[model samples]
Target: MNSPPHPPRQALPTHGTTLTPQAFRTLQAMALGGLLVLVLGWFYSPLRIWSNLLVVAYYLVTLALGGALFLALTYVTGAGWHVAFRRIPEAMASLVPKTGIAILVVLALRMNQYGWQLHAGAPEGTDAGTYWFKQLWLDPPFWMARAAIYVLLWSVLALSLVAFSRRQDRLNPQELPRAIGSMKWSVRLSALFLVVYSITFSLASVDWIMALEPMWFSTMWGVYQFAGMIQATLAAIVIVGLLLRRPGRLLYGIFRTDHLHDLGKLLLGFSCFWMYIWFSQFMLIWYTNIPEETSYYIARMHGPWGPVVLVSVLLNWIIPFFVLLPKPCKRSEHVMMKVAVVVLIGRWVDLTVMVFPSTVGKLPVLGIWEISGACCMIGIFGLLFFKALTKSAPAPKNDPYYGESLSYHCS
Candidate 1:
């Protein structure tokens, strides 16, 4: 007969069992209700509400991309660092599709905001000529099609990877082929998804955010948003990994100091990456001072929004530079939690900076409209994310890497 199940263990400095199902449901309901209020406020302030959702969708896309990319890199490089910690992030990724629908709602609202949907009947000769000439590549139909394709690709890859792992869990270890097959599909799909993500996200950036100032264009915008994704996804994984370390879950013995170190290191590395991309974007614009790029900067640099810029840079890069740069700090669980909190805050600021220049246009309103909408998304994301995570065994038990992961170490 099988032995007794492991007792639910406490996490961190506290002493309590793993999150009970009832408690989990209660927390989820609270968060979901909060998000509902935010979303409902959209009716009164569509631009404000939709813009925030647009940004949220942007981050969600990155989370899934990060997950798919991480899984692929883990498999291809055979990196042992992530094996113990992979599934938690992998599970967070499953939230991508549910949020994808939310994104589509935001996308639909954009067409109405800018009249991008009514392209065919321009007012006259040279104006129409110039408009179509510049925007032929930025048509609304193309954006919708590409966005759908991106979501479909992401959904297939993410769900398939998770489902395949679940299938393997029910079988004997000798059914290693099933797990290997899943890994192989995951790796291949991840590569394709990355390419598609780059193209589609760059295009979507133009359609959704950058197009808010259609005259202003930046080639590095896509990569810039991508950097935010890395930063946010890194924090997300760290947070979830820490949470799942409670006993009676898959991560108890699996998530070791080495795993935490690797996560901390990723947080540090991505912090630098985000800074590099942001500077690269600004440098080209500042040096050339072209009318298009200059306009984008002018909107942000000259007024109430300038402080937002400083906050974005400071939160996204500066604080982390100090917190994560020290070797000792990065390895500590407390410091790592601090790092996650700051990065998450920074990402919110970064998204605000990216869009407020166009939509709010120097308007700095922190009223219920923005607050309620954001609270809703946050609550909903928290609800769906943990819900999706707990549904499975919390980790892939029969995964081929399970043995290596359970005893993961740096030596």
Candidate 2:
């Protein structure tokens, strides 16, 4: 018996096309405007400004980290369907080290404000020695060192893979053996990065965000962060893919309904996964009725933050779940783009719920601080990502799996 015929192959454009000059100028203006707003907001409400900073920084890092994870998973699994769109994630991954440094700068500036130092007093009935031990473990210097290590590891892995991939573009397509040989190191490094990422990302979540409430603890917190990261990252990828598919764009003709459908499925699945993690964390804490853990919920469940929490759920899961269920929605580029936008905004709200209650407390205020901070970070991300995209072919022309990816289709 013979194998089934592949879908018709499509022509891919060569590299060198860049973002329009007008587009670059617009993005640069947004970046500067956002920075100005953040600066002005800082003078009015320092606490709110700082909280927004943390939220934005962490959100950017998750995006970059998600990109790395996407690449690693595809490489390890030998997935070929995404080879045409891999450059987007590669560019996103390259932003990781820069975002890490930005996060470190924020932490250094706000070192005195973290609540861990106050935990030295120990709770009633708790042993002082144990409390002090925990405090020592969370020492600011050690926390900073771990963050640097995570960034260093991610930077090395992402840059190495990109270097090898770009080098392939310059090689002769007939050198199939050399092409395969070039990708072998990426596979090996991806495997290693996956292991390192699982451990370090979890620890980083605990150290950076969870540590805000030094008294509260959740075993599921890391998973919660990871789930949200994946959802947001998928939404971002879909959005970028759509944008690049426009006429005269670098990625035109490369992405098809099948690729969009596959991406949509992942987006749908991860949206539910994020909700599951969210509910599990909430249920376990609510049922156990532990004051320490419950306090974390109490801060958000009451007052102004409560409504935002509900909206976050609806935007992130409920809407996307129902909307993407139909076959048509997933396959349609316009429909998926709308869903992706909602999920992206939902992700910002989710991150807000996580950081604001701990930092700003009962006074859940959203003003120039939140808006400016988000705009600034997003503007920076756009600038860096588009810059990276211009550095190489938007699609991997010489990839071993490029032909298969171009010809991929659903039954």
Candidate 3:
């Protein structure tokens, strides 16, 4: 028998488009349901609701930052391989401003949820020095001011990057010189943003999450958060790339398996990095046997929290680490898709472990409230991301590296 002829290839769009109606409606329901849940959860359990919202806000912000940060890294290093799918990260970064608003709202309304805020000026006890320091370091106005600065700075830089990239997309082939200039500007801005993001994000982690237990401190907290952020980011990129590769999608034939394999490598590497940070933090605390330091772990590693911690490790590190180790797995879209989902879920679980123990109690709590809050954030993120994605070409055809990116392959 003669071999069957290949099916005709579908034409792809050169520019972005609106979300399908079904997608829009689905995201709409998720957002509405989340709002309803928040309202109901508020009445049912006030503190719990607030705590969940805090988790959602922080989680959303970090994910958005991860997108922008990923873009900055690619730009600074002159990585051309990502240019074909750059719009996805650009859309992700677009969420920074929106999430910034959510975070500010959470901080403003639920400022007292944090231990530092609650006991900022409480009567001094045995640890008078510590109390005094909390009073100074955790000052509410100062804290809010710093948060505002972070939001403003991050929003401006992230938006500028997106804006510049979009502008470059409008250029024609003959405008290559101008496109090169834009790329140069992107590199300079990316470098500045990287330095600024490093210091600000570290302080932000300390202020927002680490300050949850005022008496406990870990020097490794920032790096730990960074690892998780980048890991999830890589997984997210892989997921989006795979999704876009679906038939009739923007990246139908543009985003290839080679890109997927490289992304898998990143996912695997960062999964290991996340585990490293987790162990380093745990080992140092266990070794020192210091009350202040151990107190943080005591809450998390004991009681109902113990199992949750275990689950977090398995989901965040163990699963992704082994799943993507094989060369074939990385190139298989199905395998990579599932692993990416696991890593993203693991990220949420990790965040839950970090936020809840500090806010709720030693025992773990999961209910409609937490679920609803997450749904709301995810829904909003999808909507905003799609909106941003539609505002420009799905890929940068005018970038100097666009051709190189399209032909990118791993030996």
Candidate 4:
């Protein structure tokens, strides 16, 4: 027999969600305490502190950028399922400007650590590839200018897309035509943003991370970074979605398990993609057996760093792939949250593996310096995210597809 009609439900909340006073204080303490430790460590080991700062700052930037990329993608593809909890990604993207500034500061202080920056001149017998890279591409002023351009362009586009969404929220139902027009413009802007973002973000991966080991270059480095960004970003969305699903919360009745399942699917897909890119790069380099190319892997794959790499793979791919394979695991709040936490931690470790070996060249250590720096960044991220979350309605109400989003379900 067919089911009877259900009663009408209460409307979604109009206002944004706020952080409790105690929660605000906790994040404040975490940020400050971590800063104090980093400052104290700077006196004792400035290089270590700088390295950690660079890693964490880059991590922060990628997370925010990933959020923007997510928005641009969904908008361009006309994906409406995310409309119900779109504010989470918007809040996440709003951190781009703040994190952009953070990254510039770190780059100013630490760009010298890159091998290209330290080389006064290419030595005799330098290959044509290395020569051009050093002379044309690695010019410090040009590099900095490019970095500035990337940051400025991305900040404008990210914030503009966000502004467009917020503007749509003010329109009444009678203004349906205007909302549709706005979405059309959004589609155009998002398409432009993606074209720009793909090129810039790829170059960014080369300039920021790959350049650290100046002599070692992988053609797929950009793809590798992109995969990790999406994987971690999806994990972050899941965590935030679950948090907002708490009783009396903004997304209490809005963000559903079906949505979580979709996020989990993306998480699993990207984890596999990340591994594929990683293996492709590693396998190609190994097959070629080029000394310069092999040196990068040698540094990371041998000695103390070997175990770290193993753990990173396990956390980033092995664990998530298996855990999320089962359908129920993806739909369970506790299960999804734990996996998201694992992916986030794995992202940090994966970045650490990429950075530390190039800078410190020592065994991996999650000592006071690394731990505190992470605490500081995580705290800052939380504070900014919640602040952005409270700036508008917890869920977008004027998005043309908002109704469809509310009724979204998996078959």
Greater TM-score among 2 and 4 belongs to 4
Candidate 3 residues 375-407, lDDT tens each?
A: 897787778877777777777878889778766
Name the better of 3 and 4 by lDDT.
4
Best by lDDT: 4
**Tens digit of per-residue lDDT, candidate 4, span 262-330:** 899999999999999999999999999988678889999988999999998999999999999998888
After superposing candidate 4 on the true structure, give the runs of residues whose Cα lies further than 4 Å from its correct spot.
Answer: 1-9, 116-118, 123-126
Worst 10 residues of 2 by lDDT: 1-10
Comparing 1 with 3 on lDDT, the higher-scoring candidate is 3
Residue pairs of candidate 2 with colliding backbone atoms = none
lDDT of 2 at 201: 90
lDDT of 1 by residue, 1-411 (tens): 221233232322222234567856766665666567656876777777677767666666667667766665565566656765666667766876877766776787676454353354554322454566546655677666766777777777677756755676677767767777776666666666566666766766666677766556688888887788878888888877776676654465556666777778888888999999999989999998766458778888888888888988998899888888877776677888888988988898888888766776676666765665556556566667766766666556566776675554442
What value of lDDT does candidate 3 attain over all alpha carbons? 0.84
Q: What is the TM-score of each candidate against the true structure?
A: 0.86, 0.94, 0.94, 0.95
User: Total backbone clashes of model 2?
Assistant: 0
- lDDT order of candidates, top first: 4, 2, 3, 1
Compared with the true structure, model 2 gives a TM-score of 0.94
Candidate 1 weakest ten by summed lDDT: 1-10
- List, residue by residue over 99-178, the lDDT tens digit for candidate 2: 88888888776875655555457777544655776677677777778878887887887777778778888887578678
| lDDT (0 to 1) per candidate | 0.69, 0.84, 0.84, 0.86
